[model samples]
Target: MTKQPSSLTSIASIVASMTAVAIGNGMMLAYVPFALTRSDAPDWVPGAAVTMIAFGGLVGCVIAGPMIRRVGHARAFSCSMALVILSALAIALGMHPLVWVLARGLYGASGNTNFIIAQSWLNHASANHWRGKAMALFYMAYVIGLGTGAWLFGQIPADGNLPPLVTIFFTALALLPIGLTRLPTPPAPAKVSIDIPMVWRNSPVAFIGVLAAGGLSMVVQGFTPIYAAANNVSQGDVANLMFVMQFGLIAIQYPMGTLSDRIDRRLVLIGTCLLILVAGFLALSATFSNLILLMLVFALFAGAVETVYSIANAHANDRTDPADFVPLASTMLVAWSAAATVVPLMVTVLMPVFGPRTFIYAAMAVAALYALFVLARLRKRDEVPAAERESFELKSAQMPNAGALVEAEARAE
Candidate 1:
């Protein structure tokens, strides 16, 4: 990623990354929603199929790093696309539960690597100071993919087998850019011999913030379709419910990034977690009929937890040197992916006990727990001198203080 190649290289990387995620996430947004409202499938079957796919996805992340290194990213990523597209076509032709599991698992396992590696590539090109913005853009691509998929979700017919065929076609649509681009194969991260401990000792806020963000996002994504379905909503409404979450995803990052730049990223992070706390409460309290209100509440929650990981990234950058950023970033990305895998499995089991709204309660509880720890860790940081405090502020603040001389010139004028 640090190769400093042509702007087309950068553009290609971003486009490839975003497109891969859009199609990969297209499966995510569409899979459960389709299964939920389909005339042929039962309710629990959707959850069962998704849980297996997610588990396969979890296993996929473990091997992706080494696989990317061994075979190179382009081939690795392209193979994943082929597998996913083929699987979608198979599912489209028929309605076998086992094939649904296989398609989705292949989709999950292969889907996240391209997106993950793309971020690593983007991180390589970005300066540490601007990395927060860069990472925000990278992560936003996933949300945008999800957003686009939800809108596209309706184009799939509501009949027994048609939706899978639509999914297969769009899945192929997302692969075209990669096939056309003349981009060089991006380099993989260096293999880490050590699983460095206490890396977040100075910035516990960042450590927990990211994990919690991953947890909340995975839970909602894995199960929101189930929640909407049990409430008697249509497939389109389920798509829109996921879209509302993506809407939250796109709407929150810039302001949060700006606030992190201005004040302590830690506080911005904590404040966002608190927002999730409120959102979780509101989200859990609602009955089946209140879909619109639930959408608004979860959207607010999405803004808080989803984008806060970028702030956590900024905070992590604060304590490390330029050289360590890439390795640390790879580690953090792994950590987040690992949590994203586990969160759904744990929460899905809760659905039978707590009803389909398990994601809400679980997200709220996790957010509150992480928020409290972050605040506690931040207490020591609060005692730092005012001068020292500003030193850790985002580098963007050192510019002329929002047009300082303009006021004096206005008086002269």
Candidate 2:
């Protein structure tokens, strides 16, 4: 009989895969719309293209669980990686707007499933005590990978086949670690179902918090570069801005995560939204005028925006049974992706008519509205007992169902 690889081995493999693909994925995110804008495509195309990626993500979340159940986790992961490579190649070979849109859609589906595979694997491997830190490390890996990719974007010329070719290299590199690792895949997932009402009942704050996170985060990630470009920021500095935002996110991750463990996570969620409002106001004031100041404030804004999903996840997990983790996560992702899908398109369509600062106004409105919702929720439910609360972990905002592995363990218990 084969010996099971230790959690340490699984973690190494998972983090390695996340880091590698994130570099590629990060580059792709910036490259797609930036490329569209540079090509003098219609203003709506860049945002429309971004919306397609989000739409693809919604499709990915719906399918990833069942795909893992059908093929088994390891095989499912391999399939997603294959798609990643193929999509990147398509993007490299063709710059036609239609081809670019289709390639990005493929990348979005496959890329999101890839992360879901890794996160579910990591959660399965980690002990309860260690899961928080392990997850935080995983989050850090992507942040660093993305930061590195954005920095490289500044240095590399966008012409020719070089950008997507480089993305393909990293996507290919991601496969090596997973292929060699002996770590076991999580027991196959059960059939997937998204029960949004169940999740809303589990934690109303989490339900709304995720929507707030998704809507604001998509705007930030999808449009920040385009917004920067519209305001006359240089291409290289735009890359630097992306890098700085990631740096800000990482710097606060540990502190915010640990604090969520100590206090009412709802309170933390409220504070985070407030931070977003303040940062949005600052960013609008800066209006891409002072690159240095904008970067500084945007970092704080990004940092606050990034933490909402994780804190809300922790809050929801506190109220939920481990047995329900899989479905609860699915529901949450659906909520997130639903918001993600519509919000960017709204900003994109309005930006040309209302001007570039539209994203700032929309993001601020989201944060403000969410904060008010949390305030109402706070008056309704008492805090979960401190002892029952799960320790917090940093989670990616894009993919929702990271808790599937926890369900198997819950069943075994």
Candidate 3:
């Protein structure tokens, strides 16, 4: 009886900590790009900064498993949080483009590593019977925190250093919960080898799908402020756009996952791609003049686009061996992070020549190409049977340890 209550308390502490950092990350997501657009930096600098962040995320994934093993979860989490605060302060104080790049890199590294620690700790502490519920709660924390932060971005007066300072405050707040928790630190996450080739061999669709999902979703979330700034959108409206789009991303996850569980997951991916294409068409076809309509289309688009990572991940796990689950998780995140790194650089080159609409155009091409590829593969491979398929969970590229948790749940069952 006591075990259950204690487990719940520990899980709650982890969630609180995760939510605080996510709020800070959400603010930085909007602030960085918008600030760059207003600065004298070249058009490509925003994309470059994002690319560096992705690069740092890859670094985080590599280091997290070992870092936790060496220092334990509580200490590792604190260290990562400290790095986040440092990065935020750097961004707050620095005006140079190179400084922004370095700060964003550290931000990405710490943010990704911190999430891995939080989720892993939550997984370790959760009672097996209700682990799924704990994970669901964890998912909600991220979405709520991120959305709240974006909304706060709009609410905060942009006067002087207030915006970045508020972000620093949230990052600082994250340190208190986990740092002070009475619960014991969870065991170190086991080191798993990541192999991209193995991922491709097991599920080509998942490989490509996560890549597309990561790239598309990252661009939509990370670069939208740049697009708005380019189009002369007010800061308040830009923040509103981010809030609405994030809401859409959160709203669509379960419905799509539930629907995917009922039928072929590929079909769901196809539908999501179509939504992306439709959103792109809407954006290009004079919808920008009407803010409400534009927001609706973007909301729809974000919901569909962001859901791709989880669906693709579930699709792969359906076909993967239990022994390989950890590796699969590691590999897919690598794929996701890699695409996130490369795609922004590619898009930025075009954005400079074609203006803001180039973002929409690049997204359309990715959607069209990914949809076609999935279609081609469908003819080559039959769908995994429903009985054998893993129940879909709402997932994000940020939560790199989710697949390992899924494996643990299966073992618990």
Candidate 4:
């Protein structure tokens, strides 16, 4: 029998995982955009430049598990952190737009690999009893990190070299815990052939959820700061708004995750969609600088669900065999990548017409339709018997073989 991971490992991993994600968020919000804005590039140049890096990140997510398996998590994560530090130093010096974009993309991959590897570790480490709660905790750290990053942007000078060097220093510091930990190695995952049709068949909604979550969330993340500034919303208020929103995500993730674990996953999914819709409407009305109302809307919008990334992972986990977790997660991440690529371009187009707040409005409008579609699916499937529904156990006896991962290994061979 495989020895189950201790809670100590779980806790320590969570912290280390949290550090990776936090610093990753920090780097993205802090370094990349700063470099882009500070570059001698034209207005449109920064967008493409930022996308260049983010697109690579999406690629990293797709290949994360196999990379981890081949290189091992610690090594992969360490390398990523080191790259992030280097990227930070580069951003502090303020490179050319294309160079900044390339560096950001390279830096972005570090976070992607770190997250995927950490998640693979978490999936293997979890006992069935605490799986949902544990996943919730994993998500909570990410939530905190995202909110903290936005707030830190306000605290740190966006165009200055100091924030990059300083944030990089802190990110480098995050490597210590993982290095010091004496965690045992995870079991080798099973090697299965890839079936694109099979993954789509198993988790279509989850796949779409990946789109809604990634597209909407990216629209929010990449543009919200710019949006707030464009609007009359003060910088302090914007930071506070994000802070409250993250805190709301923190408040809700565990309960919502556990709630999903209990009920039919569809209902849980619908609930998530509804939350986004409400958030959308609230944000749409948030054109006013009414501080209370803005924060309230942000809080509502942020709370009730945070499934953007985590839910798809959970849903994929739910529908998949335990052995398929890593591979399936990789498949779901592609959905994130596809959405990330498209949404920014879409929102950027909207900016000239609706101003910067257009991203949030666009997010809400998209989510409303998505929620409706999901609701339709739920209603159509309502007659299906619960027992007939396949519920997944997140853990598998062995891991699924990701095709891309195998190809990479074959190339290495």
Candidate 5:
């Protein structure tokens, strides 16, 4: 019998696909609002448009598992990229606000499908000991792509269709590596129940952590600029704030993952949530004055909030049988998508009533609730011993494939 090559051999192509998706996402995040602002749309239009993307993501999460099973990862990813390209063209064509909302939603859904495919493939390919480091590299690539996309946004003129066109070009470029590479496809996942009650029973901290982190992440990415602007921060500075936040998110992944591997992951999760809560309150109270301090706070908030997702995922893995990873991960991704979809709309209502700082308040509330839940869970259940626990791997709800990879790995063992 011939020996097959390890999945790790395809790492380069996986990372490339991840990077492309991230860049496209980052570009859209910056471009959509800017384009809408120029269109003389009402204030709610931009936020609603961004929220539509999350809503699409929720829809994508529901379909991606089945889609990947039917078509294989490469083709599924290709389809996602095609959707992104078409959506970008639709936006560039100066569609009506309502049409743009639908287009953006398509972009969100397709982008999420790409994420699931890449992450699943990576998880399936990675050796056990190398999983954490592999995830770190994946995260680094994702963050760098986002930062680069934001930089591209600055270079492109917002006045014309150029931004979306450039986004389309990048989305197309992302397809190249996938099309050219001969990557192995994972088999169809086994049928397993994804009961929310079972997930919480297994790991409440992880369950709540995912929900809170989703809310925190969406608020920061979708509304931070608006929050800054309302506080009289300059537009350029708002861009800088997001850049610093992304840098913080990139910088923290490996260190946090390594730390979680060594100790109680719940402790790491709790500490990070506290930090995010503190940063959120500080940002709210100070009104984002003192540019340097504001950037630092934003960075801390972004880094901590983003890290929670991975920690929660790792924590959930600690509690579940290896075979259950796929269903558990899918459920968590759905939880994240639901939170991301609803939180912004909730904030939109709150902002008018509570003032522009409402986003910060929303973040703080999430952080506080998560922290409290973690503490309570600690009291109710003993920690998984470090010796017995799986090594912490930095994952995002963005990549739904990790679960499938974990299931495959379990079967191999």
Candidate 6:
């Protein structure tokens, strides 16, 4: 038997750390909305809070590359975890609405930074042959952590300081594995110029897929809890729903990635968009009283929408040169973040006119637009030959480290 690479060993440690922090982040994402609604805060407040987090994510993604170069991955990750702890403490102390918004934004930035560090580190460390499989494993671990967090939050009280304190405990625990791991620092990334126009010109389908996915994801993951609460679903059920949705997300990553590897990724992307449209409409029309059926619908919805980032990313890479991977990925991340930041606010506005179901309509609309774009692209360009295509790798907008890994693999090849 051959000995495994030391970089692979280090990646395992980083995965553990990432999973821990993701659990806390996932719990907070659902808990905040549920808690605020319980407090009789206005309908728009929850969606606004979610938007703040996405805005902070944009900031984090912008600075993360430079920060990682300066501090090294382990130290940068630790600093982000520490910031998360501080943000949780702020919420625990019962700050005012404005303060809570600021704290949530801080949480988003720190959490995004941590994700970037872990992803970049893993990609930097893993051998080229193992990159796709390694990233799939990382994505699976992340989804599991998120699902576990949602389920755990359901078991605890959302009122008072308990929720934030739990978040702090988990976040603090995430730091332990990082401190213990003795890993080599990755080489600093070369600075790349982001050209959004070039990226779109290269693959309009991919650009729109990511943008639509971002908008749909914020509604599904960020606003769904509030929607459930508004519809008279019990807090326990809301948590369970979130866990089910995350479970769908976790269950689909490897299968979708494997399928994309075997076929034209455009076909897979179009299928996913159709799935989102159907699921969104069904979810909107279904009576909330049928808990089991609703859970199933949401599971399908999450599974499909969550796979968009990976599929779209794979499609984009298929169309571009290997040298362009880093810049292309960076541009897409920014675009996705911008869409996520704005979509929730739109939800806030539409909720008054469309009620709690506005997010569903929003999901349907985006899915339709994305499907149209994918069809148009098919007519305009021939598919990339499978022999020339890169292996499909799973990715999440929350984890923007794949770009660095793509550049590393390109250099190796």
lDDT of 3 by residue, 331-362 (tens): 87777878887887788787778887776787
TM-score of each: 0.81, 0.93, 0.94, 0.80, 0.91, 0.94
Q: Of the candidates numbered 2 and 5, which has the greater lDDT value?
A: 2
Tens digits of per-residue lDDT, candidate 4, 1-413, equal: 35656564455754664555574464456345434444455555555544555576676755565666677767877777787777767666765666666776776576566665665556566665665556556655666666676577566655556667766767866788777766655544334344556667767667777667666656655665455544545545566666666666545555666666667666676776677777777777766547777766666555543554454556655565655544565565666666766877777666667765677777777677777776776754432244543333222100111122322221121
Full-model lDDT, candidate 1: 0.60
Worst 10 residues of 6 by lDDT: 401-410
Query: Candidate 2 or 5, higher TM-score?
Result: 2
- Cα distance off (Å), candidate 4, residue 135: 3.1
**Model 1 stretches astray by more than 4 angstroms:** 1-3, 8-10, 13-17, 20-24, 33-45, 48-54, 121-138, 192-198, 287-290, 382-413
Off by over 4 Å in 4: 9-14, 20-24, 27-41, 45-50, 62-66, 126-128, 187-194, 232-235, 252-268, 308-318, 323-326, 379-413
lDDT against the true structure, each candidate: 0.60, 0.79, 0.79, 0.58, 0.75, 0.78
Candidate 3 achieves a global lDDT of 0.79
Query: How high a TM-score does candidate 4 get?
Result: 0.80
Candidate 6, after superposition: displacement of residue 411 in Å? 4.4
Higher-TM-score candidate of 4 and 6:
6
Clashing pairs in 5: 120-401
Q: Cα miss at 261, model 3 (Å)? A: 0.5
